[model samples]
Target: MRYLPLTETDRSAMLDAIGAPDVDALFSDVPPGLYLDGPIEGLPHHATEMAVEKHMRRLSKRNLAAADAPFFLGAGAYKHHVPATVDHIIQRGEFLTAYTPYQPEIAQGTLQMLFEFQTQVARLYGCAVANASMYDGSTACWEAVAMASRVTRRKRVVLSGALHPHYAEVVRTMAKFTEDEIAGASPSLTATPDDDGLIARIDENTASVVVQYPDILGRIPDLRKIAEAAHAKGAKLIVVNTEPVALGALEAPGNLGADIVVGEGQGIGVGLQFGGPYLGLFAITDPKLVRQMPGRLCGETVDADGKRGFVLTLSTREQHIRREKATSNICTNSGLCALAFSVHMTLLGEAGLRALAAENHRLACIASDRLAKLPGVEVLNTHFFNEFTLMLPTDTRQLVRDLADKGILGGVSLGKLFPQEDALSGGLLVTVTETTTEEDIETLASALEEALS
Candidate 1:
């Protein structure tokens, strides 16, 4: 049964109050092509339960699950083996049902867990402190830009060409309302990242310079050099890391002189759950700049009985304060995803993480070597962690579709990421993780050879 309860008079009153003539007029901002004008052609809304279930089951089979193919897709989200224990621990009733601790004092267990998560993120990022979490990496990147503006009292943000395009877009989209000036450019096809060019763009008015470590094309950028150049002009250096596992192999952004580090925690505890419900990790190397940071910061305190306690330290986002004073408009953090990350990090520890990183690099080297030997494929990275770029001879968009048709999940194509840029149409990003077997690489190599030929 349909559940819309609004009477015609009630809806008309609401529309008139908003100065909109009808319900359709309320959605006038939406493009006409996007929304449906009438009921769907064939499917009945009130079909029998059995019929609906049967139809849904048939539709579900069309999806190619990651484990079922020679999967290599990773521009931001990755496919790694999550330990069974991570799922077991997070699914427990105590943790599973928990969301944000609004009445935080009584939610000791949740607070303690968040405090631990913060500690793990801080150490991982080599930052002085970290917030509980944010919506995801893109939003966290925007928050860093906002924080840098507050610290430097400047409106200009210098974005590196190698920064993730999606992250860069998120910053630009949010900047439209905030009046922040975004200076962005497309990534070059050079083997190494253009650190000097990025530094040259920084000026006195620049609030922050954002760079992604092991950047979009999977080439490692010189963070220390960029950090120094930005700091010389009294601008903050915001580092974005999409693959947290790379930090286990590469240097932490904070340790390399970044003022703030933001990244996706999905590489850790969270698996690629069809694009969403991923975690965001935010941290700052300079403790003095903590107040300007977004989201919630959980801290330890002594209770009335002198016992250890956990509490929300700074939640200056829109919910707790006047809108004008809020450091961010973000209202909630990814609490469950944060817990999953903490548990995975704890299980890995420092040594285990390093070992895991080494294996990923080993496998990636093997895959890259195999792929580079192909007749028309050119490796674009002089140095990388586990992921790298390849300049292919063919239009990778069509090639990717062909590979998928052959029951193989190929890497992300540049055409998909930069649909408008004709020059970048053939670049393909290949990501290798510990879960990717040698056979999978062989399968991809053979497929590429046959397809390219």
Candidate 2:
């Protein structure tokens, strides 16, 4: 039997209080076509826990598990080895079920963990402070742009060609309703824009300029000059990083004079579960701009007893208190994923992370060198952390499909991501993480060569 605690009389009384004649009246503004005609088909009306578990288990067998394959597909998401300890700590009863740490008295542990995670993120990105976390890297990118607009009081934003396409799209979507402007350059394998370029597009009206570190194509550029140019025009420089692991070896964006640093935290400890359930790492300089920071921030303090304690501090801009006037409407961040990131990084420490990053770069270079030697393949990036694009002689879409038939997961084709851009149809962006081995690269290279031939 199913149960709904809200009695029919209780619901009707509440609806009458709101002056809504019926539940359908509450949805009166919804477009006719947008509403479903009826209930979804084939869903079970009722089931026992055991029966549901058995049904789900059968359905799960049809899905492809990442562990079951020698996976290499990383356009933005990646596969890395998560230590056993990460999952162990994350599954602890307190950490696993703990939601928002709103109450400091009872939620001290959860708040403290988030505070530590924020500190680690700020240090990693070389920013002054970090919020708890956001939905994922893409949303954080959008939030950063919005924050920049507020700080500069300017409406226009300049985006580098090196920025990820998905991040760019998300920003544009978010900015559509706002009184802001966004101009971005064409996507490319290299950070160097065409002579008629990204710098030329910046102006006094520009609120911020965004670029990616070890960008979408894995080309790492010295953004210091670009940041300087934007600063001259009174525009803030926001840098997005998809792979936070690269920060262990590469110069931190804060060192490069970036005003804001945002990225995906999945590379640290979280698995690439389809897309996500990943954590968004957002940080910034200047405490003056801290009020505009999205998401909750956990701060350290002392209680009445005077022992060290942590609480959700500086939350004046959230939806609860400020409503539409809030800096961001974001609530309920990725708490579990943030815990996974913190636990994983705690176990790795600075030394382990750097070593892991070094291995990733080394493996990627090996893959690039071998793959470049293959017929009709041209390596595009000169300095890359762990990923690069290969300009193939044959159509990449056709080649990748052939490789997939052989049970080998191939990299993403540029054409698929940017369908309107025919010029990039032959370029394929491939990524290699610490988990990839020589055997895996060789298999990919062999399969790619066979497919191309």
Candidate 3:
């Protein structure tokens, strides 16, 4: 029952083949004092199943779940009410067991779903094409930069100040081994985003200008202007969208001339399962860049019988292509999450999506109006879909902790996002969706007043 695949003789043979005396010899470099000899300090050797279950239940009770609090947190991952229908569909036997479509003949259902998902994403993003899906938004942002570097053959990337700090860091981290040069700055604590300043940073050497729509600070930047400037300098415009719901109300970045659009698709259908297995959306408005895009692209086609079907028309992942020629090294796509998003989008048709967006903005405006009346609080953005930055009179990081102590999942603090930037210290990023109620907003407002006073 204890499924140990290898016998001691088998292990010894392998270790001997590798010229090791024993397993302990394998870890010769590890400090003897640091090595554990036996049972860890004081843990019980064993426990009854019921006892363990009870212990776990007690531990879980300490966690302040999003539903149990006045949740306002959203930088990348969001808290939205995913319909029961989304779950029921994704849990089907066919979808639950679906994996990479190595053979299209047997995976018609999976392929067709992916094809439909891609179509929905393409239309949602206003792009000519969208990949099946990627890891998550931050990594997708990095992929966009790498793709831009490939298309333009330039090494310099200019990042907007308002771009998500996590996304920017991911780009910088990935750029270490590559020749790409990243030019980035911390966001300014103002209602207006520095579009002009960002444009000035773009030059002939720039391969891409990356900007986030409904940015980390919750202020929307003018993507069209940024796109035009990037084009003038022969640089691709990479737009990152963290909140896909905002797109229902705001113009798609692709419509504003973004060359490559990458973002987190966690806002729809996907519940924030404590950070991940979220979906990443990557698309291209310019069809010319399709060959250079990452991940798989499912396209409609026919088999030997000539009946309409679907297949992976293009997969540039390293698995399906020569390592040197592959567009991306991603092992697999986020298939299940993509299915959930597609199903949710299908349920919320065009009208439902718009109505959802309207309610979000309506509630957000109400929260903003109520909070702005506080003695030292100021809502920074003059316009926003559902999320915005609030400049607090006190240190925001401490205030957030204080709010959390009161069982309220307060907004993200700029200090936590960009710790080194003193100018951004007091900023708080608050998000509001239909799930956030008028009472929740009041609870937060009352809590903020009491704390500030």
Candidate 4:
């Protein structure tokens, strides 16, 4: 009755063809102690549709839905108001069902969308060129590091203490297999983007220096100094941004002398659908680095008819060419998500995006001021876009849980991300978006006051 089509005979034949004795042989490398002895204790082997649905509903009730509460949760992923038009446009068959635009002639629509997306990304990041897209922000961070290494012919990467920990981990994981040296600093929970130590760590072997704009703790640091130091040491400066909307108000990283700018595009036109299907934004100021860039690049050109058309110009992935010669192993881009971003951006235009960004900053300022007035709570950042860290008197992990119990989706607990750091034990990372209303902010403030009391 289960949907699995394979029978014992069919599975046996396939295994024999592959020269494996049994199905378990496929997992032979797994240690005996790690294997489950039997089926899980409580889960049912079978259940009716109605029964399963009822059980799932009960489990779903245990989760505090962000939209249904006074939500303030944002570490990297943020909750924003996505227009209904974005969903409607993306769901159209031409956009929704489309995959990679492998052929130039027939896939003009898809290619054009990617072309527009790339152009928008380049403009937003203040970079000269941008690819179609990558997996997400974190993977894009790794690709930037890889690209920098290829460009500089150096194996060492310097990571700032203010960079998002998850992004840093991705770079470290990729570097570990490649045998690259990574000098990563401890997470900083301060107002200053103090990179003196990070700059000192850079050496002749350094390939790139990765730092987050309006860093993890939400401090907006001047990147020109860092960029100059990295260039002086013959290293590239790769700036990371988790919130793309922040770029609307802040100066572009490229203008600040960043060689490469990469970030998550989920804040624009994309909903935080329980943490994605998110979009990755990658851009570079120098055109010479295009060959080393990962993912696809869409170019506008004239066809045989002399009409302007879009095409996949640069596909450096293994699928399109020789595996050994490929610039990146990433096979495809987030086409539908990228399209949604494009549509939303087109709707907002330049003026609308700036207004949205300004509103976000204003709301955050109001929230931070109110929260800082609470007893035993201190706002950590001197300058920020819309998100900032707070130092609470008590442990933030339990405090977040206590807030959640009161129908509030409180901000992320810093200690949960970096448990080894005693300084961050009482830290909380809160975010305020345009979607965060006055009522929501007040509810959060009142809830925090009660929780701390």
Candidate 5:
């Protein structure tokens, strides 16, 4: 049974009504050469459900799961232990079936959870307030840059060379339509800063300076100095944290004078479900800038009888209200994922989170120390959290492939993302979470030795 809702006559009539002589007229705006010459090769006009399911399953089988092999991969998305209870609680009918709360009065529980989630994020980042959540770490970082520019009323955005490549691309894409000036610091996988200096580029016209915490190379920057430099030029400092677990032991980005702190909350409660549906934590300093922040914010309020209740506040800047003038067009909230984060953090508490963070750092340090002893392999980061970059004597891409064949999930290859660039073409960035065990570290170390040898 074909499921075509419209008949040939109906299509013709609709096209005629729209004053288009043919269906091809609808796509007149698309250039001739750009038009597809034929249909896609693999896709069929029709297929059985079982065939489609089998095809999808076969394609999925090609992918290597994190648990399938000794895994060690993290630039932004991480492999962390998500307790079964977190999944159980989020899957409840009431919470799982809920959507964005348009009516604050009827959505007390949802609003309260969001409010508590905001509080947790603010405390973790040392900021005044946080939104519910954004799309992901990259999108959140992009929004932070845009918000900083709007707040400072400036045109220039300075991107650190050490910033994640994907994150830098997102910012560049957003800046294109606004015609804002974006200067990128030189690209390098090495932890140490070389000739291309971004700190020297800041001036009065600079709206914001963006740097990543435990950046692409897994080296922690002296953000206090960078923040001071940006402030001296009247620019807001937007700090990005792809891995938020590092915050448990490291100085909060807000305390280092960061105007905005943005990061992926996957390490907290979200699962690395093949890099999807992760929570983005966005926080800012003063209450004045709260209006410019993206996403919904939940606040405590009083009912008509003076009883306390929670409600969605300052939603006028969302897509539902301002339309084109909205601070963010985002509508769907990572509500369940955010709830999972809150629940996990509540269970961990401050001390437990700190201990978990320390354990991650310890594992990573041991792994780096062991791997650095191998010939032709060098540890490039002096200061880091749970992740770091390694310089390989051979091409990192080939080394990674070899390691994968050996049943070891190797770190991300720099050359894989930046193929044209020379600096990062030979390096690989590795991460060790609290979930990573000593045996995992040994396997990675031994696998790298065999792959290189």
Candidate 6:
């Protein structure tokens, strides 16, 4: 049965109330050439539900599934092993049905989860405080820049060459509307860290110097110099961590003097479901800047009976406060994803996380070492956590496709991300997680060798 709530009379009344001649008149402003006169060009008019489902399944089969092959693709989104227990916990009725904790009295369970999430993130980043969570790492990075601008009263944001191009683009798009000056350098594809140029760009007018930890190319450069340089000029050092698992092995950004630490938290308890609902981890080192932090913050408190409880501590979004006075326009936190992360972190604990991080690094090192021995291939990073870039003999874009044809989901092609940069035209970003097996690494190495040969 067709489900049209509005009848001709209702439509006519609405049109008449708006002083429009007819239904077609409503779209008079749209150009005739651009308007669709009928059903979309390629779609069928109708089909049985089962037939439609089968057709969708056939279409889905054409695309590659990361898990079906020896997967190494990681340029922001990663493939990590999420425990089955994490899913079991998040699917509980109380967790799955819960929404934002607007009222603390009735929403104590969710509030407590968020409070625990915040604590986990703060400890993971080694910061004083962390918000509940943001949209994702990219938007969270942009928010950090905006917060820096607010704190320093400056408009210039300096981006490191090693920062992910996609993430840098997000900051650029957000800065475009606010008239913030963005100084971004071309991607660094060399063996040694090339951050001197980025540091030189920071001056008195700069609001923030944003650098990726174990950057897009997967090199872990010493950030102390960059942090000091930004601090000397009254600018904040904002660190981006696309892969949160690296935190398990590397020194926390806050301990390294970063003012704001933001990154993707999809590595823990979150599967890479086609780049969707990933977690965003945001933290601040100083207490004075807490008010400027965006999104909702869950806090711990005591009730009148002296019983410990949880509540929504700060909600500076436009929905809760005046538009002009709000710290950010983001309405809510990534509650479910944050819960997954909290649960995963709780299960892993400190020792387990460190071991997992160590395994990732070990596998990455083995893969890099074996791949570098191949003809005309060079590992670009002297130090990396679990992911790194490789300079290939031929164009990386074609090589990636060739690898895919050979049933191996090889690493991301840098040329696809930054086509304009000739230096990165032959670059490939490969990642190795705890999930990567010895056989998988060997398969990639052999396939890569055959492809280049």
Task: Residues 339-377, candidate 3: write the lDDT tens digits.
Answer: 999999999989989999899999999999999998889
- In model 6, where do residues sit more than 4 Å from their true spots? 1-59, 316-319
Residue-wise C-alpha lDDT for candidate 5, range 339-393, written one tens digit per residue:
8999899888899889989999999998899889988899998888998888987
Top candidate, metric lDDT? 1
lDDT of each: 0.91, 0.86, 0.90, 0.88, 0.86, 0.89
Provide the lowest-lDDT 10-residue window in model 4: 313-322
- Please give the lDDT score at residue 211 for candidate 6: 95
Provide the lDDT at 102 for model 1: 65
As a whole number from 0 to 100, the lDDT of residue 214 in candidate 3 is 84
User: How many clashes in candidate 1?
Assistant: 0
lDDT of 3: 0.90
lDDT of 6 by residue, 58-119 (tens): 99999888889999989888888888999999999988997788777888989888888998
Over 1-453, each residue of candidate 1 has an lDDT whose tens digit, in order, gives: 335698888888888889987677767788999978778999756777688799999988889889999988888898888999999988898778866776766788889999999999999999999999998999999999999998999999999988889999999999999999999988999999999999999999999999999899999988999988999999999999999999899999999999999999999999998878999899999898787788888888898899999888766545567576888888789988999999999999999899999999999999999999999999999998888998998889999999999999889998889887888888999999999999999999999999989
Query: On a 0 to 1 TM-score scale, where does candidate 5 land against the true structure?
Result: 0.87
The number of clashing residue pairs in each candidate reads 0, 0, 0, 0, 0, 0
lDDT of 1: 0.91
Candidate 4 segments whose C-alpha is farther than 4 A from its true place: 1-62, 316-319
Instruction: Assess candidate 6 and give its TM-score to the true structure.
Output: 0.88
Per-prediction TM-score, please?
A: 0.88, 0.89, 0.89, 0.87, 0.87, 0.88
Which 10-residue window in model 5 sums to the lowest lDDT?
187-196
Better of 4 and 6 by TM-score: 6
Deviation from native of the Cα of residue 149 in model 1, angstroms: 0.8
- Candidate 5 lDDT at 18 equals 100
Candidate 4, 74-177: lDDT as tens digits: 77888888899999999899877876788878899999888889999999999999999888999999999998998999999999987888888888898989
lDDT of 2 at 55: 92
